[model samples]
Target: MQERGALLEVVVLHPRDVPGADEGGADRLFLVNDIESGGLSPEPGTVSRLCRETEIPVRVMLRLNDGLTTTGGELSRLVGLAEDYLSVGAEGLAFGFLDSDLEIDVEVCGYLADRLPGVPWTFHRAIDSALETDRAWRQVRHLPGVDAVLSAGSVRGLDAGCDELVERAAADPEVARLLMAGGGLRGEHVPWLARAGVRQFHVGSTVRPGGSWTKAYVDAAHVRSWRMLVDDAVDHELARRTTPYT
Candidate 1:
C-alpha cells in the first residue's frame, strides 16, 4: 500500500509538556492530559499557553466527568471552557457523550455546537463504548460540527479488522475525513494501518520511556523517538506511493 498526503498525527497526552511546548519536531499536536484514564478537561492555563506559543495547530480533547457521567450544567460548563480554549488558539476539540444504551448522545453534541465556534471537533473513542458500534458511528457522524470520529473500529482495538475503520472513514467524505486509529496503537502497527488507508494516528507509550506519575514532566526523549518513527512512516508511505518507477 502507498501513503497519500500527510496521514500521521501525534496526540500529546502530557499536561506539563503543554506549558513549554514547541513545534520543534511535530507535524501536529493533540493537546490533552492524563492518558492513563482516558483524559480530563484541560486546565485553562495549559490550553491557553499552548495556543499562545505554538505554531502547530492545536487539537483539544476534553474528557468529560473525569471518567464518569456529566450532568447538563456540567456539560454547559465544559462548553464554556472549550469556547475559552478556541478563543485562545485551539483549532479543534475532541469529546464524546453516551446515552443510557451507550449510543452517542446527540443532544449533548448539539449543545456543544451551539456553545463553541465552528472549528473542528472529533468524537473520541467514547464511541467504542457504545453497545452498537455501527449504530453509534452513524449517530455521531451525523451531528453538526462533528468533523471526525476517532475509533479503534471494533471493541477489540485498532489492530483488529482495521479495514472496517478505513472503510468507514472513506465512506463519508462530507461528514468525516479524519479517520484516527487509536487504542493499543504502536510504531510497529502503523504500517499495517497505513496499508489499510488510515491517515490519522493516536499514540502515547511509544512516545514515552515509561509513563510515570513521579516524573513530574513529559519525557523529551520519548516525544522525539515516537515522532521520528511517525515521520519516517509518513515519509516512507508517501514515497512508496508517489515515487515514479522508471
Candidate 2:
C-alpha cells in the first residue's frame, strides 16, 4: 500500500505551548484539557487564545468526561458545549461515544455531526475501542461532517493494528477521509506505517520533550526533528507513487 502525504497533529497540553507547537511546523493542534480520560475539550478562553495567537488549525476535543458512555443529560450538555466551543472559534471538534454493547453509537454520533452543520469533525479514538472495527468504519466513516478518524487501528495501538489499517486503507482510501495513525507513532515507524497504508500521523506524547511521559512540555526542538522526518517520509512516499515502475 502506498501512502499519501499525511497531516500531522501535535497535542498541546497547555495553551502556553501553542506557539511552540506551531514553531515546530504542526499541521494541526490537538488542544486537550484531560489526557488520562483520552482527552477533553479545552476551555473557551484557551480556544480563544489559540484562535487569536496562532495561524495553524486547532481542534478541541468535545469529550465531557473520561468514560465512553455519554448519554441523556450528559449528551445534551455535550451538544451545548459543542456549540459554545464553535461559537468561541474552535477550528474543529473531536469526540467519541459507544453504546452499552461497546459499538459505534451511529444514531447518537450522527446527531452530533448533523448539529454542527459545516464544521469538520473527527470521530475520536472510540473507534479503536469498538468491538467491530470493520462495522464501525462502515457506518461512521462517511457520516456527515466527519473529516477524519483518530485511531491507532485497534485498541492495542498502531503497531499491533498495522495490518488492519493497511487493509482498510486499501479498501477505502476515502474512509474517514483519513485513517490517522496515532498512539505510539514516531518518526522511525512512519515508513513502515505508510507502507501499511496509513497516511496521517498524529503524536501527542511524542511531541513533548521526553515523549509525553518523563516531561510535560511541548519541546519545539523535538517537534522540529519529528516534523522534518514526517515531511520527508510523506514526500518520499508521494514520489514513489509517481515514479514509473519496471
Cα lDDT of model 1 by residue, 1-246, tens digit: 333443334566544554322432555677777666677777878888766666777788766565535687788788788878888888888888887767778887778876765677878887777878778767876787876677787668766746666566556543224567777676666665564445666654445446543454445566566566656766776677778999
How well does model 1 score by local distance difference test? Answer: 0.67
Instruction: Give the clashing pairs for model 2.
Output: none
Off by over 4 Å in 1: 1-4, 13-15, 18-24, 154-176, 213-216, 219-221, 235-246
The C-alpha TM-scores of every prediction are 0.79, 0.91
Instruction: Write out the backbone clash pairs for model 1.
Output: none
What tens-digit string does per-residue lDDT give for candidate 2 at 56-129? 88888887778877867777877888887778777888887889898888888888888888989887888889
Model 2 spans > 4 angstroms off: 1-4, 213-215
Best by TM-score: 2
